[model samples]
Target: MTASHAPFIAACTELLGASHVLTHDHDTEPFLVDWRKRYRGNACAVLLPADTAEVAAVVGLAHEHGVAIVPQGGNTGLAGGATPDESGAQAVLSLRRLNRIRGIDPHNNTITVEAGVVLAEVQSRAESAQRLFALSLAAEGSCTIGGNLSTNAGGTGVLRYGNTRELCLGLEVVTPQGDIWDGLRGLRKDNTGYDLRDLYIGAEGTLGIITAAVMKLHPAPVARVTALAGLASPHAALDFLAMAQRHAGALLTGFELMSDFSMRLVGRHFPQLRYPFGEPHAQTVLLELSDSESDEHARALFERLMEQAMEEGIVEDAVVAESLAQSQAFWDLREHIPLAQAEEGLNIKHDIAVPISSIGRFIEETDAIIARATPGARMVTFGHLGDGNLHYNVQAPEGVDQKQFLEAFQTPINALVYDQVHAHRGSISAEHGLGQLKVDEAMHYKSAVEVRLMQSIKAALDPENRMNPGKVVRWAQAGTRKENIA
Candidate 1:
């Protein structure tokens, strides 16, 4: 290690014992690599702070040493938001040691938890208390609440309960200057000023390190129903989704759309799962309903909607879950899509969102463009249709070298997809934050004034640019600070 980094490591190890501070290359390897194994990094050390106080201390030490700090959670983010760079100058500040649920207020319908707590653990804790923490994701078992909050994660439940930003009530953060900002409150009606908590919500650690959060909760649904329906096209899926929403209203918790290619990959990768339908339909819509009333009523309502959709030619065929186990099995198929795609082959994935009314058109036009641009390329599109987000992916033709295909078509494919999204007034990124993965792409879509405003905010908050530099916002233009405030 360099002479300058020696003191920083010593201070981190002193504040959090040697066991908590990982300096050995082998120990810090996992934190340096992203989940997709696409980007690898090098860190001077890895600091595991046990609590908010320890986090503050670590931040203070890093600030004193003028060393950059990269905050990381469970590291399950699709974007390279949590992965450190290969500078070997930054210290990875891991929040895993702060995994603790502080309090659960049933009367107020809220729960306070440290940022390091896993998403699934929070859900389980809420379930234990007869309440529901509704942020559901495929990586719930590993992704931490901090990372979710940082990226403003959206998943299946967003149709009913909204995204991570909607679920969050408050956050406790350690600023770049080493001061703790205690904004943790469970109040639902705090109409104070600019809502500062939101600034760091999707900042991806560029603004500060999130230590804990107070999240909203809801009463557990007493009844639930799930259904799988086959449709002729994306337009049909949209039509069915609208019909289901009109019937089920707020009880409609999920509306996922999958293409025929997506189902084929799932069936091929996961043979244990039995297809709900006998024939391959062009599109599939997975719907879920939840209510405090009778589950039979919910099931019947779904069935009637499907029947009406079929009569209207919006639905080709449908299968309602007959039992609770069947409902879970259907959901299992939807949640395992990413894994199945991985097993199939290397692919280029885009997590994008458009207007609900424009999604059908977007898919139709984009598919045609993709086919024309790269003949024989397979398109696997699926995601929370209710939220207007789709995981549109592209797979190379059979017998083609994956690397060569990506090299030849990745840029053109992205141009075609993003152009449509931009034309339709859609966001380049739906749920995932603008990490290093989309730093340049975001610039293409965002205006210079908008980018400048974001950079101004970053400079105002973190003048030194020592917190996750070169992340969501470009920090290269942030000139050197004249003074140290802290």
Candidate 2:
């Protein structure tokens, strides 16, 4: 440890036992890097606080020392939001020890969980209670609820259950100044003052540490229908989605659009997983119909929609999973696309979102630009079509060097795609927060007034620039506090 931060480490060890204070470089190395391994950082120590009170004490200590605090959970965030900076002047606050389910109220349809609880555990608890917590992602197995809430994560079910922000009812937070804001109420309505709970939800811990939350739950779906439909293009996929909505309405829980390239990568890298179709189509959409009705009803609805889509030529061929295992198999293909991509090589991923009405145009125009600029670069596009979130990613050409392709064109490719998204009045980041990855990207796309307002709020809540500094919004100085957060 540095001589300058020796006192800081001693204080942290005194607050929480020496066992919980990770000071050695090897012990703190794992917490310094991100899940994608794209960002590596350094930290003086990692503080593992077991409860809200301990977290409060640690935050107060950091504030007193003027040392930066980076709150980390499972560290599964793609945007580097939870990773510390490389200055080694910061303390990584790990919240994994606080994993607990405080309570579950079946009648109120709410589950109060500690921030360190894994998301899958919350879903399993809801299932045990015969209810559902619908915030799901590929990283749910390890990603903590605190990380999910902090990023306001959106997954396939966002079309139906809404993002983490909508799923959240209340939050227990520890501010940068070490004050605890106990807003953990299960009430559905509370308009007494400003929506403080929301301000912290997607703040990426730049504002405060989310220690616990009261999340909403829904009745478990009695029946679910999973299907894969082949489409001519993204336009046809959009049409097929509208047709399913016309037929199934709210039962259309998930609608994911995947290019044939995505499936091919999965099929090639993962030999055990195969494409269900006899032949590959340029475009395909995974249809999931779920409801509280009978299995027969849901399956029939899925079949009816597929038949009509084929008749209208929106879908060429389709397969409706007849059994529960088959449905899981269909989902496994969609969930493992990223894994297959990782097996192949590195690629630039753009998590952009546009209006459903503009999805087709965004795809065609963006692809054309990419094709013209970087010929033969494969477009591996797919995502939650129901919410207009597209994982528009580009793989290096078969013959071109991956590093050369990315280093040469990653910036231009991002600009082309983001320009298309902006033309449609869409977002540069759909589910993932800006973190350090897209702070400048967000500022470029967002309006001046919008950017200024965000900076003002960041300045107001964290005047000293102590909490997760250099994230979300760039700060001015320690004393340059804005007067209004609103």
Candidate 3:
């Protein structure tokens, strides 16, 4: 450790316990790397603060020492947002120890929790209260609410509820200046002033560290139904999506589109996960309905929708899960695509969103472009079709070295996909924030005015540029201070 860093570490240890201040490599390794292992960093120590007060104190100490702070939660972020840099100067501030469910107001349909609380735990708590916290994803078991709010995460339930930003009504944040801002008001309408809550929600800790949040909740659905349908093409999937919306209306809670290749990948990796359809179609969709009525009513509605869709030739074939186990099995196929891709090897991943009407053409054109660019490159395509966000990923062809393929095509493929996304009036990042992975690319796509505005906000909030630097937006010129930008 450097002579200058010792005092900072000692002060942190004094504030918390020596055990809470982890300096050993073995104890700090997990916080240094991201979930995908795409980013590996070095930190002098890992600080575990027990509550928001402790967190504020640690921030104050870091500010005093001029030590950069990387606020991390769960470390499941795909964009390397939570990972520290290779520089050993920074300290990782982990929120895992601040996990506490403060309150649950069932009457107001709101739940307040510390940022370190797991997403699934929030769901379970809401269920216990006979309410529902609808922000859900495949990583719910381990991903924390703080990380979700930081990235404004959107999961399957966005079609019915909304993204994490929508689910959250308020936040308590520790600013870079070592001050706490508590905006934890559960009011549905608070048109008080400029919305500081939103500024921190999707800021990815560049502005401040989100400590706790007051999340909106809804009455739990009485019955839930899941169905999988095979379609001839992406165009057909869009048609079926429109029809499902018309039939089920608000009851249609989730709608995910999966390509036949994606299904095959899942089936190849997990042989036991049975494909619901006998024959493979070009595209498949998994649509869900949450009924306030009864299971029979949901089933009848789904059957009617399927019959009409099939009769109109919008759906080639369909199957509705008869039991909860079967429904989970159906979702298992959808959720396992990323896992299967991981098993396959390292690949270029793009979390993109396009206009719902343009998805088919976008995929059709982009897939053809990718094929012509690199033959035998496998595309793993699937996501929330209802929301127009797709996890469009490219894998190395069979018998090819994964590392070599990524090194060869990651750049060009990203450009091609992002170009198409821009052409279709879409976003290169839908749910995942632009961590180190896409921060530069975001600069290229965003207008100068837009980039400047973001820079101004970062300068105003975190002038020192010490909070999770080099992740989101960057200064216009390298090594330039906030004053130079203005």
Best by lDDT: 3
lDDT per residue (tens digit) for residues 228-255 in model 1: 9999988888888889889989999999
Candidate 1 is scored at a TM of 0.97
Compute the lDDT of residue 11 as modeled in candidate 1.
82
Task: Give the alpha carbon lDDT tens digit for every residue of 228-334 in model 2.
Answer: 98888999988888899999988888999999999999999987887899999998889898879899998778778878888888899999888989999899999
How accurate locally, in lDDT, is each candidate? Answer: 0.89, 0.90, 0.92
How many residue pairs in model 1 have overlapping backbones?
Answer: 0
Give the residue spans of candidate 2 off by over 4 A. 477-486
lDDT order, best first, reads 3, 2, 1
Per-residue alpha-carbon lDDT of candidate 3 for residues 1-486, written as tens digits (9 for 90 to 100)? 478899999999889999999989889999988898889999988999999999999999999999999999999999999888898888999999889999999999999999999999999999999998999898999999999999999999999888999999999999998999998899899998999999999899999999999999999999999999999999999999899999999999999999999999999999999998889999999999999989999999999999999999999999999899999999999999999898888888999999999999999999999999989999889999999999999999999999999899999999999999999989999999888888888877877777778888888888888898888898543333442223
- What total of clashing residue pairs does each candidate reach? 0, 0, 0
- Score residue 260 of candidate 3 by CA lDDT: 91
